[model samples]
Target: MAEIDPDAKRRPASVKELKAMSHPLRVRIIRLCGDHELTNKQLADRLGVDPGTVYYHVRQLVDAGFLEPAEVRTGESGALEKPYRSTGRSWWLSVQLEDLDTSQGFAPVEAFQQELAEAGPASIASYARFALHLSPEDVAELDRRIVAVIDEYVETDTERAHLPAHGGIFLLHRTPD
Candidate 1:
């Protein structure tokens, strides 16, 4: 499940790409594509939308350069289908509340903060699925393992074709190293 681009490079998203991803469905679509390249039909099946709807969203993402063509496969019926991937591992949308204050004032800021707080919990939970009871020594060992593993991922400048089933680990732990 590890999402490996094999060719990942730190390419920042342009302003246009960021704007296109601002939509909630489009954002989710990007995340899903990050995990694996998929066709519009596959995405629609997974998202429970009609294939046409998924195709439209996918095209918009493609136009913004966030989505790249990955593969072309021939269907059993002889039609060629295209698979698409997200070019970057993640995206950030930066909104300067300070800048907005001069124009829109504080309500927009508060609303933005509230939405982030509400959305964060589920995103966190979806990503975290393990709990361990450990002694101090065990905790230290875990930390070592995590750091070593993370280092392994980052040590190489370029990623590979397939990541491990571990889904490209993002280890977060606070302990004395």
Candidate 2:
């Protein structure tokens, strides 16, 4: 949840994709896609939302190219459901850091970035709940290194899956920052 590295040569998320993710349900979909490819039912159940709503968001993410159809599975109704995988663990907005007014382009990307920064505590707390076995010092160093990687690999190329998905390691040093 640290500030994204501005000079990391990261590719920025497009306005359309950022807008698609601004929706709360769609954000959950992206998180769900972090692991295994999931059908709408699984996502809806996990998110505590209606299947119809989940279906709509999944379609939107797919259309925006944030989610990809990894497989197809049939339900009890014999309806074919498309299981989706998240294209990336996270996204970085590329709007100018000093741009106060976003009247033209990438406003949604900027907005999402601001929203995430404001919710930093929640991110930190949630990240803390994950299980990781290691000594204190080693864990701290691991956190620093993983964050550097995630922060550095901010470039997101929708044209190709250059970054590995479903693989992330977070470490918290517990030292004052």
Highest-TM-score candidate: 2
**Candidate 2 per-residue lDDT over residues 1-177, each given as its tens digit:** 555544364466666766676665676577668556899888888767799998998898888888889868886799987788988734544433333333333344444454456456455423345445679687656644665566655444333355443322332323443
Candidate 1 lDDT over 1-177, as tens digits, reads 343332233345455655565565566577678778888988888777899988888898888877889979887789998999987634323333333323333333343444456456544423456666778799757755655555455545246646442223333344454
Model 2 stretches astray by more than 4 angstroms = 1-9, 74-79, 89-177
User: Judged by lDDT against the true structure, how good is candidate 1?
Assistant: 0.61
The most accurate candidate by lDDT is 2
Pairs of residues clashing in candidate 1: 1-165, 6-159, 6-160
Clashing residue pairs in all predictions, respectively, total 3, 2
lDDT of each: 0.61, 0.62
